[model samples]
Target: MSLREAVAALVSDGDLVAIEGFGHLVPVAAAHEIIRQGRSDLTLARMSCDVTVDQLIAAGCVSTLISSFVGNSSAGSLHELRRRVEHDDPAPLRLEEYSHGGMVARYTAGASRLPFAAINSYRGSDLPTLNPEIRTVTDPYGSGDIYVVPALRPDVSIIHAQRADEHGNVQAWGILGIQTEAAFAADRVIVTVEEIVDDDVIRSDPNRTIIPAHAVTAVVECPWGAFPHAVQGYYDRDDAFARRWSELARNPHEMHVWLDANIRGTSDFDAHLELVGHPRDGRLNVTEAFPSPVNYGGRR
Candidate 1:
């Protein structure tokens, strides 16, 4: 089956999809394709929201969101979500704020198949105020410190990596970042990679291979998959686009127009490439001029 199909298999109506990546690096490309194909009543979990969140929200694929924050720092700002929340829209966006360590602990508990994991990171913090479900239970073993957090098991997990084998072995390159836990906790896994290397390359450095083939259901080779988002040394992020999106998002009409022009109405990345101009041989011209922003009936 194709990588998209493999990823799509894990998604269903009303599934809670947990995506592994921060800002832009290592986004679940195949999962996005699946979402574009149309699924409803979806709840998304991520460290922070960015282009991926914007695209899913614009597509109307996401019914709820669970993240610490949303919007691109480089983008002018994130107002759409804030406005929606402030207005208390019927389908008000669900914002679950958690500390960095708390988020990691939740994912780890999910991966371990444990009912809850003990942590003392948020003992005196406001994190519990936002999420009252995170109970402060005493240590069963009589340990003086540490509290337990309920396990978080998403229906499916989609992640991106630098390389993978056809069998689905993934090399996260030291920035594992919740992927290992996500893989352990999710019912299914779908992975996308820059390239599919030989099994020998993966076997040679077993420690580097974060996700084993057994855990991954699909492996797709997607070059430049993390466009507009950075992948460490691989490519510079499109901070300009992010900034513009943030600025336009303040006005709903303008946001829709911008989405239509850039993301929506476009079939795939190739079309997006045409709209934004493709990088020359995997190298972008930082000095090259960018297109002027389209007017969307909002403050410019």
Candidate 2:
């Protein structure tokens, strides 16, 4: 299915949506669609929010952000997020903060159908004070006081992968990140892949099948879907573009102008790629590497 179709069908305003991919395979394209559709008042969840989430924040689609960290890479301030947190530029954004470990535990709990997850985070820190949801409980095993975060089960989870079969069995390697847990925790899962491969390819390497078909609601084949954020074997991150975006994001007017021309003005990701001189003249492409083939075969 097409990404636009998937987003339009499954995503609704004011839904708890999560687009997870960690550092690599960030679903920038899907976020752009969310912005393009003008969906408002959404509660977004991500472990490492990064620049991809920043785009959604800047667009004003997000009402509340539930995350451990909002900005990780770009080696500089994510200006739009900072503007909202400090200045309340466009609107007042509510933030639900947690530690990286706490977030993972929360997602784990959500996937496991638990009420909350206990972790050793924020013991001496003031993060607990900021977030009222963070609670303390005495360990039943006599380990002492424990901090726990509520399970984060999103209404919809969108993630990028290297490939998926027709049945929507997602295969991702390099850094699998939190896509699996996020997908399982969500009510609906939308997977955008660089390619749609045969079932045999997936069968040959079961270990790489991160999100199984039964958990996926939709599969979108979108090459370069994670542009400016790399897709492991497909392409590399576009740091220069990211830095340029940071510069524009400092000023609201300039930021919107760039978005208008690059994101909203374009018909789709392919058009955006064309407008930005992508294929990067073949510069962003990665070289193929041969790996030892593992047999997942038996007496058929």
TM-scores, all candidates, are 0.86, 0.96
Error of 2 at 147 (Å): 0.8
Candidate 2 residues lying further than 4 Å off, grouped into runs, are none
Residue pairs with colliding backbones in model 1 are 75-242, 75-243, 118-147, 119-147
Per-model RMSD to reference: 10.6, 1.4
lDDT of 1 by residue, 38-58 (tens): 777788888777766766765
Q: lDDT of each model, Cα atoms only? A: 0.71, 0.87
Q: lDDT, candidate 2, residue 75?
A: 59
Candidate 2 per-residue lDDT, tens place, 35-84, comes to 88888999999888777777888777998988888663755778888889
